[model samples]
Target: MVFLDEPTTGLDPDARQEFWKLVSSLKQQGCSVLLTTHYMDEAQRLCDRLLLLLQGQVIDQGTPEELIERTVGDEVVEIAGIDELQLQGLTRQADTWYRPFGDGYVVALPTQRSLLWEQLGSLQPQRLTRRRANLEDVFLHLTGKVLQ
Candidate 1:
């Protein structure tokens, strides 16, 4: 077993890739690795299972895909630069779940995505983006905070 805590912090991108290759090789050799990292991308790529911590307490644990599916759903929709009234109106929509993010909201889209787009269009947000939900989204949904 090998233990690493934030092992790749501050490394250049090329170096980071090299480090990941090393870790992958170790796993391929059947070595068990325990790694700690603030980089969600790294965690998602390298780990088979993850333990999420908040305020030094374990808040959740699962495979990366399981965590994202359980917390943020299939898609993420972000609407930014909207006023308070628009935010209020959106919150009232049934079957939609959202949380306040910087200058806007992060919405976890339901299985029915078409209705969500229609509702968002009615609001005419200054900026809107839709993307597949990812580990970062899960982290934000679970902790209400962004990792620096």
Candidate 2:
């Protein structure tokens, strides 16, 4: 077994890529790796499983999809507009999982993008964006700490 601490730290993409390839090779050779990293993307890309921790305590553990389903649901909507009234109006129709995002708000949904789109359309938000709630969001929501 081998333990690596931020092995990819300060490395360029090419270096990180090569490093992961080496790690994978080690795994295939029956070596076990225990890696700790702050980059959620790196963890998601390389780890077969993850344990989420906070303040020296293990809070959660699971595979990526399992973590995804646990921290965030199906999808999230990001709305940017000129006024808080517009955000409020949209959020009212956006259901319970809505949250503020700078000059905007994000709403998490279990399913049906069309419903969210329709609600947003009715509000005529200046800029609307839609995407899945990825590891970044999961980390922030669960930890209340954004990773830059």
Candidate 3:
């Protein structure tokens, strides 16, 4: 077994790639790896299973995809320059969940909702985009929008 905690934190990209290759080789040789990191990309890439911690407590644990799907729903819509209060009534009517993000808010839209599109269009946010959810979404969903 091998233990690494933020092992690639200060490595340049090339060195990080090299480190990952070395770890992959070790795994192929039947070595088990235990690692701790704040880098979501690293966790998603290297871990078969992951535990998410907030405030020194385990918040969720699962394969990355499972965590994302279970916590963040299917789709994310990011809209900037919109007030949370302004969207509250619409969001309630539309079947979407909204949380403040950097300079704006991200609304988690369920894939099954066809009416949400029309509701969003009516609001005409300064910017809006649809995307699939990932680990960051899961983190924000489970831990909330607050930085602390």
Candidate 4:
């Protein structure tokens, strides 16, 4: 068994890739590897399961995809340049999850994009992007959004 704590923390991207390859090789050789990393991409790439920790407590545990789907849902929409009033209005809508991010908000939903479009699209945001949910989304959802 091997335990690696932020093993690739300071490595360049290319070096990180190489390190991950080595970790993959270890998995192939049937070695148990316990890895801890703040980099969600690394965890998603290499781990078959993940343990989500916050404030020194285990908040959730599952396959990365399972975790993401369970917590943040299927899709996330990012809208830039929204005001606090708009945020409050959006929050009051039925069945939605949202969080404020830099100069914008990240909204998640399992369905009802058209409904959201009807409500928020009229605002004509500076930038609006829709993407599939990811581990970071799950982390932020399960844990508090406030920076520690």
Candidate 5:
């Protein structure tokens, strides 16, 4: 068994990749690895199961896919460059889960892109993007805070 806490925190990208390879090899050899990391991508790629902690409390635990599906669904729509009034109006109008992101909000959708488009078309957001929900989205949704 191996315990690693933020093992790749400051390593260069190449070094991180090498460490991931080593961890994968250990798993293949039937070694138990316990790893803690703030990098959601690393956790998603290297772990079969995950325990999410916030403020020293266990908030949720599951496989990466399971956690994402349960918390934020499969798709996220980002609407940016809107003012506070517009944001509030959109929040009230859209009947979905949303959270504040960079300069706008990220809305979680359950594969219904048309609904969002129809509503957001007239708003003329500076940037609009749709993407598959990931572990970071799950973390944001669960904790209501972005990981630093």
Candidate 6:
């Protein structure tokens, strides 16, 4: 049995890819694999079944598609800058939250940041953060960003 609790937290894409292949092989051999992850892409591509845990309790559970449809059925946008100065003014009208990134910000939005995008419509950002259902979105929703 192999238990993975966020095994790819800091692993690069190549490493995560290799780790996934190994886990997939174990599942092929009929090994009972139990795991916990905030990464939706990993669970979607790897697990036969997934259980989402929060504060030591099981909330709603389902496949990535199911969970995403139920919670976040909106387009996502990601914007990165030296700081969230533009993010602060542009995001005041929509639902948004700041997820800390080293020396900057990684924002996740359940709604589109049209206002913000228009403001920076010309100034291309260093990075763009979308509401795509990855590990971060799953954990954000689970942790209750909007619910907060």
The CA lDDT of each predicted structure is 0.83, 0.74, 0.81, 0.80, 0.83, 0.63
What C-alpha lDDT does candidate 4 achieve relative to the native structure?
0.80
Global local distance difference test of model 5:
0.83
Candidate 4's TM-score reads 0.89
Model 2, residue pairs in steric clash: none
Per-model TM against the reference: 0.87, 0.77, 0.84, 0.89, 0.88, 0.57
Candidate 2 local lDDT, 15-60, one digit each (tens): 9999989998988899998999999988887788999888988878
In candidate 3, clashing pairs total 0
lDDT of 5 by residue, 86-141 (tens): 65566455555677888888877655444565566567889888889999999888
Residues 1-148 of candidate 4: C-alpha lDDT, one tens digit per residue:
9999999988999999999999999999999999999998889889999999988999999999889878877888888876757755675573666787667778775464447755667778887888888887787777866311
Off by over 4 Å in 2: 82-94, 98-105, 112-114, 145-148
lDDT of 2: 0.74
Candidate 6: residue pairs that collide: 38-135, 39-135, 76-131, 77-129, 78-128, 78-129, 79-129
- Write the candidate numbers in order of decreasing lDDT: 5, 1, 3, 4, 2, 6
Better of 1 and 3 by TM-score: 1
Residue pairs that clash (backbone atoms under 3 angstroms), model 1: none
Least accurate stretch of 10 residues (summed lDDT) in model 1? 87-96
Model 1, backbone clash pairs (residues 3+ apart or across chains), number: 0
Name the lDDT value of residue 84 in candidate 2.
60
**Tens digit of per-residue lDDT, candidate 3, span 89-108:** 66776656778878778777
- Ranking of all candidate structures by their TM-score, best first: 4, 5, 1, 3, 2, 6
Off by over 4 Å in 6: 1-19, 26-32, 37-41, 73-75, 82-86, 96-98, 109-116, 120-126, 129-131, 144-148
How good is model 6 by TM-score?
0.57
Worst 10 residues of 3 by lDDT: 139-148
* Runs of candidate 1 exceeding 4 Å displacement: 145-148
